[model samples]
Target: MEFVAKEKGFIAHFSYGDLHVSGDDEHGFRPFQLLVSSIAVCSGGVLRKILEKMRMPCSDMKVTAEVERNEEKANRVEKIHLHFVITGEQLDPEKVKKAVELARKNCPMAQSVEGSIVLTESFELVS
Candidate 1:
């Protein structure tokens, strides 16, 4: 991974020709948003795989991450709430709950910020 500085922000170049711009909101993605996205996407992917492995049918999934920042302390992120909406057929609430728990426990991004940030998850199933 490498980053090149532009006039307003930096462009991050990653493997596979992927590029992300990080800077002010007007220019590109903010640094904090990227952090939250990493956690959300990681957990979402894990949850999806877990559900598939358990033979749970899912047609669609969406993950939204909300963050609480402490303005007094350098505007640091204090908490992150991840809401997952899953659409499927005949979904079992108990199974979905278990998969979410497992994903939270196993997500590398969540684990990295475990001590410093409060991470919470909620899910709703649509049939």
Candidate 2:
């Protein structure tokens, strides 16, 4: 697997395999962005299936990540928080919580960052 990045002003063009991405950040999907994105995508995929199995059909799901860096480190993310907003009809809070727990345990991304970064999660439900 090879990845390449080219800089063009504030945006950087990135290509890897069949994936193409452009980002305003200097390094494109910087380490932190890639890390958080992994977490978001992994959890999202698992929860979608879990929700379906629980008979709670989700209409939409969005995952947002907020990372705080340590001043001393200058460029390292010290802590990260993820928010999962789920929209569906008659969603069960218990099932949602359980799904999140299961995802955290099974998601590869979450497992990958286990010892490196601090991760926290919060859930929101919208009717």
Candidate 3:
């Protein structure tokens, strides 16, 4: 991906659209926010797939990511916690828990940050 400097930050061009990235929130999406988003979304997607493959498809899924940064270490990312809200009927919590573990292991983004950032997951089911 190529990024071009803008007045406020930089814009990266992709087939879908342009992504604005910067340190300042007003300028664009902060780098840390993007990082956390990528990990959360990747894991969520993988989890969804696993659920379907395991015959536990959900009607809807929403993922929220919470990030922890270390101030003493130049504000680097220390951990990311992902919470998933799944809406469906008769969804077994045990099976969902298994899927979560599988997702964390299969997700490329999660695996990429394995040694560096701590990744955790939780979920709640709605009928």
- Most accurate candidate by TM-score: 3
What's each prediction's TM-score? Answer: 0.92, 0.78, 0.96
Candidate 3 deviant stretches above 4 angstroms? none
- Residue 54 displacement (Å), model 3: 0.7
- Candidate 1 has an lDDT of 0.91
Residues 73-97, candidate 2, lDDT per residue (tens digit)? Answer: 7678777888899999999898899
Give the per-residue lDDT of model 3 (tens digit) for 14-103: 999989999999999999999998899899899989999999889999999888999999999999999999998879999999999999
Q: How many residue pairs clash in each candidate?
A: 0, 0, 0
Candidates ranked, most accurate by lDDT first: 3, 1, 2
Model 1 lDDT per residue over 1-127, tens place: 6788888888876666645565578888899998999999999999999999889968999999889999999999999999999999878999999999999998999999999999999999998
Output the number of the lDDT-best candidate: 3
Off by over 4 Å in 1: 15-20
Candidate 3 Cα deviation (angstroms), residue 37: 0.4
- Which parts of model 2 are misplaced by more than 4 Å? 4-27
lDDT of each: 0.91, 0.78, 0.94
